[model samples]
Target chain A: MADTQRPLSPHLQVYRWQVQMVSSILHRATGIALAVGSLLVVCGLLHLAAGEESFNYFKSLIGSPVGLVLLVGWSWALFYHLCNGIRHLVQDVGLGYGIPQFVRSSWLSVAGSIVLTVLVWAYVLTPGGAA
Target chain B: MSAKDVVVKDRRNPLKVARGLGSSQSGVGHWWTQRLTAVALVLLGVWFVVTVLCLLHADYATARATVAKPWNALLLIAFVLTMFWHAVLGLQVVIEDYVHVRWKEVVLLVAIKFLAVLGALASVLAVLRIALTP
Candidate 1:
C-alpha cells in the first residue's frame, strides 16, 4: 500500500500455517460474524414481540432448512469465538505464553468448541421419549 | 542524524473554543475497550450457547419454562448484556478502522452503541416479563 509495490510484512503467504495462528485469526473473524448474527437475534425478538402472527412467520422462516444451516454455522462460530476468546482473556492476564503452550491451548480451544457444538446439536436432535 | 525540526507546513489554527472537531489520532482507547468487552463476552457467551442448546427440541412451553428458571434467566440476562456490549465495542473498532469519513464513522459508532444497548435492554425486559409472569 505504499509508494512502491513492495510485499507486505508479516504476510500469510510466507509463513507456515499453524493452529495457534488459525485459532487467533478465526477468533476475530467469528467475532465479526457473530456480531452480524446478533442482528438476527434482534429481529427474531422483535418479531416475537410484535404479535403471534409475526412470531409464527418468523418461526417458520427460521425453522426452514436453509435457516437451520445458517443457525448451525452461527452456532459453530459462536462456540469458536467463545473458546478462543477465553484463550485470549487468559493471555491478557499474562499466562499461556511460549510456543508450546500457545499451540496446545489453540488445539484445546478447537477441540472444546467442536465437542461443545456436537453436544448442543445432539441435544437438539434428541427425541422426546429418547431421553 | 539530521537535527532539523521542520514545522508541520499548515499547523496554524484559529483560536476556536474547543480543540479539533473529532477524536485525536491516538487510537488506543478503541482497542482497549474492544479487548475489555471481548474478555467479558468469553464467559457470558459460552454460558448462553450451552443454556440455549440444552433447551433445544423442547416445546414452546418447556423452552419458556427453562428461561423462566431463576438461574437460567440470570445467565440469559447476563449473556445478552455482555454480548451487546462486546458487539458494540467490536463494531466500534471496525467502523473506526474502515470508515475514513470521520463524521460518518462517529455517527455510525454512536448509532451502533445505541441500537446494541436497546437490543440488550429489550431482551432483558422480555426475559423478565416471561420469568415474572404466570
Candidate 2:
C-alpha cells in the first residue's frame, strides 16, 4: 500500500501454514458463525413463546435435513470456538507462551473441540435424547 | 524568534502524541472483559445446551413447564444477556478489522450494538412471558 509498490512484510502466502495459524483463523471464523447462530436461538425463544403450533414448526424446521446439517456445523463451530477460546484465555493469563507449549496447545484445542462435538452429537442422536 | 520558541513550535502536542497510541489503554479492559465473559459463557453455555437437549422431545407444555422453573428462567435470562454482550464485542472487533471505511464502520458498529440490545431484550421478554403466563 505504498507508492513504491514494495511487497508487504510477512506476506501470508509466503509462510508455511501451521496449527497455530489454523487455530487463530478458526477462532475468528467460529466467532462469526456463532454470532449468526444466535439468531436461531432468538427464533426458538420467540416461537416457543408464541404457542404450540409455532413451537412445533420451529422443531420441525430443525429436524429437517438442511436444518440438521446447519445444526451440526454450528455445534461444531461452537465447540471449536469454546475450546480455542479457553486456550486463548489461558494464554492471556501469561501461560503457554513457549513455542513448544503454544504449538501443543493449538493441537489440543483442535482435537478437544472435535471430541466434544462427537460427544454432543452422540448424546443427541442416542435413544433417550439427553434425559 | 528565539531558538527555544522555534523548537516548541515545531514539536507535536503531547496529547496528540498520546492519541497516536490508538486507544491502547482501553485494550486491556476489552481483553479482560472478553475473557471474563468467555469464562461465564463456558458454564452457562454448557448448561443451556444440556437443558435444550433435555427438552428436545418434550411436548409444548413440558417445554413451557421446564422453562417456567425459577432457576431455569433465571439462567436463561442470564445466558441471553451474557451471550449478546459477548457477541456484540466479538462482532465489533470483526467489523473493525475488515471494514476500513470510517463512516461505514462507525455506522455498522452502532447498528450492531442496537440490534444486539434488541435481540437480548426480546429474548429475555420471551422467556419471561413463557415463565409467567399460565
Candidate 3:
C-alpha cells in the first residue's frame, strides 16, 4: 500500500468540555506536577542532612512567596491525584462503570481535593499551626 | 505440498499482523509495580504531609532531631524511594503516550530513569546521614 497522510481522528478540540474529561486530564496533569514536586522532596532531605545552616536556608526558601505558591499548588495536586487515583483503583476492580456514577465520582474528586487544600491552608495560616 | 517446499505468506493487514503481537512481556510487570507503589504512596504520602506540618516552624536543631528519630527516618526513606519509583513509572507512561517523535521519546524515557534513580539515591543518603549522625 502507498504511504498517505491521513487526517487524524477528532482530537481534544472536537470534544465538548465535560467533567469526566476534565477529571481524566487533570489526573495526568497533576501526576506530572507531582513528579516535579518529588525533586523538592529530595532537596529538603539533602538540606536537612547538610546541617543547621543548610536546613534553615531551605526552610526560608520554601517559606517565601514563590515557594508558598508552589507548595499550595503541589498540595492541591497531591490531594487531587490521591482522590482521583483511589477512584481509578476502584474502577479498575470493575465498579463505577455507570456513567452517572462515573460523573459523580469525578466531581467528588475535584470537590474533595479543594476542600482538603483549603483545610490544610487554613491550618497552616492559623496561629500555632504549621506557619 | 511438502512443508519444506511451500512458504506461507502473512497476507493480513499490518494492523492485524501487529495485533496481540506488541507485548514486550514486561508491560504487566510495569503496570503492577506502578499500582503497588501507588498504594504504598497513599499511606506514606499522608504520613509525610503530617510530619512536615508538625515541623513547619521548627528550628534547625529541632527538625534535625525529629528526622533523626528511628521510625521517622525509616518511613522517610521508604516514602522517598517509593515516590521516585512511582514518579518514574508515571512519567514513562506520559512520555510514551504524548511524545511522538521516536528519538525524543527514547531520550526522555532514559533521562527520566537516570534522574529518578539519582534522586532516589540522594534522598536515601541524606536520610541516612540525618538518622546516623548526632
Best candidate, DockQ = 3
What DockQ class does candidate 1 belong to? acceptable
Interface RMSD of each: 4.0, 3.0, 3.6
Chain B TM-score of predicted candidate 2 relative to the true chain B:
0.86
Ranking by lDDT: 3, 2, 1
Off by over 4 Å in 1: A1-16, A47-55, A128-131, B1-40, B69-71, B98-104, B132-134
Kindly list the per-residue Cα lDDT of model 3 for residues A1-131, writing each as its tens digit.
11336534335878999999999999999999999999999999999999888888998999999999999999999999999999998998899999999999999999999999999999999987555
Give a tens-digit lDDT track for model 3, residues B11-125: 6788877766546557888989999998999899999999998888888888889999999999999999999999999999888877767888999999999999999999999
Superposed Cα deviation of residue A22, candidate 3 (Å): 0.5
The whole-model lDDT of each prediction reads 0.75, 0.89, 0.91
Distance from true position, residue B92, model 2, in Å? 1.2
DockQ of candidates 1 onward, in order?
A: 0.34, 0.50, 0.56
- lDDT of model 3, residue A106: 99
Instruction: Name the 10 consecutive residues with the lowest summed lDDT in model 2 chain B.
Output: B16-25
What TM-score does structure 3 among the candidates reach?
0.90
lDDT of 2 by residue, B1-134 (tens): 87878777647778877874866678777777888899999999999988988887799999989998999999999998999899988998888776756788999999989989999999999999999998
Error of model 2, residue A101, in angstroms: 1.3
Q: Single out the weakest 10-residue window by summed lDDT for candidate 2 chain A.
A: A1-10
Computed on C-alpha atoms, the DockQ of candidate 2 is 0.50
Tell me, by lDDT, which candidate is best.
3
Candidate 3 residue A54 Cα shift, in angstroms, is 0.9
Which parts of model 2 are misplaced by more than 4 Å?
A1-11, A128-130, B1-11, B14-17
